[model samples]
Target: MSFDIGNPSYGLVFWTLIAFLLLLVLLRKFAWKPIIQALNERETSIENALASAEKAKEEMARLSNENEQLLKQARVERDTILKEAKELKDQIVTDAKVQAQTEGAKLIEQAKKEIDDQKKRAMAEVKNQVSSLAIDIARTVLQKEFEDNKKQEALVADLLKDVKLN
Candidate 1:
């Protein structure tokens, strides 16, 4: 047989067309069905992944905002605590100073009272000594005057005449 490129036999052409149609139907039923199903599943998975990524991004943003709020609240609480601590410290210092001043005043008052008491005691002692000395001198003068009783009698009469004249 000779090689023919332009035209072939009718029976050969008909058989070839029948075989191609059979192959196309078989591939569509077996191979193409699974391929199309796999492609659909891949598309669904890609969509799911994209949705998950979007949700994760939204969650991350929400968490970031929550963290910022928490940080701000913590900072406010810290500042409030610091302010309270400073106030407490100032109050303590003021109370301590007041207590110290009160104690000092009490001590000064006690010292003044003690000084007054000592001065009174010293004055009493001085008065007692002076009175004792004056009594002793009066006793000595009386002893000397009584030794001259006859002269003391004449002197007594003159004292009585002087008293009557007054």
Candidate 2:
């Protein structure tokens, strides 16, 4: 028998249909199942990565807020310490000034008392010198008066008359 290029055979058509169905079954069992499983795994990994990123972002925000609070607390503490130090310094200066003033007053009082004592002593010395000088002058004057016996007798008679009048 001669074969014609344009003529179709029923046997070839039947075998082609059977071979196509067999290929479908084999692909479904091996290649298609593995491909679908790989796609699902990739999807799950992408979702997990997104969730982890969100958690990391929230943690970063929390840490930032905590740092800000710590900074504010430190500033407050520093201000309080500085204020206390300033108060202490002012108190010390005030105390020193008061003590200096008290000491100055005491020294002034002591100096005044010493000056008064010296003045009293000087006045007493002056009085004593004046009295001694007066006594010496009076004795010299009396010796000159007694040198004249007639005058001395007259003075004695006057003294005796004054004594009788009292």
For all predicted structures, in order, the TM-scores are 0.79, 0.66
Query: How big is the positional error of residue 52 in model 1, measured in Å on the Cα after superposition?
Result: 1.5
Candidate 2: C-alpha lDDT: 0.93
lDDT tens digits, residues 1-166, model 2? 6566699687877998899889999989998999999999999999999999999999999999999999999999999999999999999999999999999999999999999999999999999999999999989999998999999999989999889653
Per-residue lDDT over 1-166 for candidate 1, one digit per residue giving the tens place of the 0 to 100 score? 7658787888888999999999999999999999999999999999999999999999999999999999999999999999999999999999999999999999999999999999999999999999999999988987888789887898788788888542
Q: Report lDDT per candidate.
A: 0.94, 0.93
Q: What is the lDDT of residue 118 in candidate 1?
A: 96
| Candidate 2 colliding pairs | none
Give the clash total for candidate 2. Answer: 0
What is the TM-score (0 to 1) of candidate 2? 0.66
User: What lDDT score is found at residue 80 in candidate 2?
Assistant: 99
